[model samples]
Target: MARGSDRKRPDFYSRKAKASGRAARSVYKLEEMDQRWRILAKGQRVLDLGCSPGSWLQYAAEKIGPQGQAIGYDLKPVNATLPAHAEARIGDVYELDIEALGTFDVILSDMAPNTTGDRKTDAWRSAGLAENAMLIAQQSLKPGGHFIAKILEGGDVPELIKKLRQNYHKATQTRPKATRKESTEIFLVGLGKRH
Candidate 1:
């Protein structure tokens, strides 16, 4: 059998991210989705949940430009040096201080549970994280705001999408081209939150 490290060698996206000075390969996932959907607009306020390593924050900052704001929160501190318009803080999503953070025009969550090699258990945990991100979006997103969250594919995902559709003007899911072929991760895009 091939060695584990060899099996996981850097691919196109990984090399591209390195060349472009991005913090992680996951940045391409957000880039593809944002390009497709126009999720980030200049001068919009954005919140990035579970924004550790800060690649998403970096992308958001660039898209939003100098006039916009991008605030990120995660359990771990972001060590990356982001742009002036973007800032990341260490905090648990479950105990996020929404009032202090104020509302946002866009919310993004790329949070995922630590995998245990069991599909069902991991999916359940990912669903829970997505649900929590949805709740935060409902509360903090401005009327007609947008939300993007990552969730593993499994039984619980449909119900989560149902809730999103009920609350947003449009709800859909997509797997970005950057996603690994072996990965079950997909993104839920919720646009135009209702008043």
Candidate 2:
């Protein structure tokens, strides 16, 4: 028998993603969210948080059509092939000035923390990242804008949902089919921000 470390992990999603020319399987999660929420439309400016790999950027640019624009910021380098209308930068979300970047019609975040296998610690950390993203949304989202983000479900998720509901007309959680069966990650979509 192959040793545990020597055994190759089954990678259906990554293989399928590569075959479809997507940079990552995470693209399908964003696709499901967009399809359900209509977050991307012509002429809508979109912001992507932690947008490394740039698959979300590419998908957003296509959905926004030629008239719209997609902007992404990440702590690491973004290396995916993005459309002409999409732009990306290497920067931290906490430091980026939303006023300088201009308000966006929609914001999407797919950020994940570096896991250490401690479930509780990771969940709280994920919640913190989501909260930080919310802070950015308050500054960067135009009136009636939408916000979507991925978060590990646990710890302060209820509090996070409460905060989102207080800020937007509609707030809900969704787990996309593309997500692995064992994953605790889920998405929160906040629609129609109130001024």
Candidate 3:
């Protein structure tokens, strides 16, 4: 068997982003999804939750083009180097005032609560964030819009998936090729918002 140092670690996202001159590796995740689902369109209004490094914001801004708008929110201040069309806010998602920002055509969330090493606790925390993102999407997304969020593999995921299916015309899970194989995290894409 190869030693840990000798084994090649996969980082497809970083490699691709570096080749394309993007700020963060996470951009590839959005790119792949957009290519497959065509969830984004020019001039659409987008909201990005937990958008720290602002990779998703960058991807959305480019896809939405000049006429579109992208807003990002995170618990901490985002770096000042984001694209001109993208805006960032430092705030908690649960306390966010969606009405203040107005409705959006797409709501994307990459929120993952801090891991505590305890599997049960981590799962619960992650599920809470997923649920919160869903709530925000329900209030902010326009009819036939899109909602995307990060969720852990265990705990209440089944229930959450059911709930998402109820509110969206189609709900699917995705493990982007950019994500590490060892990670249990997966993204849930809810398309064609029902409410």
Q: What lDDT does the true structure give each of the candidates? A: 0.87, 0.82, 0.81
Model 2 agreement with the true structure over 88-111: per-residue lDDT tens digits? 898977787778888899999888
TM-score of each: 0.94, 0.91, 0.90
Report the C-alpha lDDT of model 3 over 115-173, residue by residue, as the tens digit: 77776877788889889999988888998999888877885878888988999999988
Candidate with the greatest TM-score versus the true structure: 1
Error of 3 at 111 (Å): 0.7
The reply for model 2, stretches above 4 Å from the true place, is 1-12
Candidates 1 and 3, the one with greater lDDT:
1
Ranking by TM-score: 1, 2, 3
> Against the true structure, candidate 1 has what lDDT?
0.87
- The true-versus-predicted C-alpha distance at residue 163 of model 1, in Å, is 0.8
User: What is the per-residue lDDT of model 1 for residues 83-182, given as tens digits with 9 covering 90 to 100?
Assistant: 8889999888999877888999999999877777888988888888899999999889999999999988993878888998999999999999888887
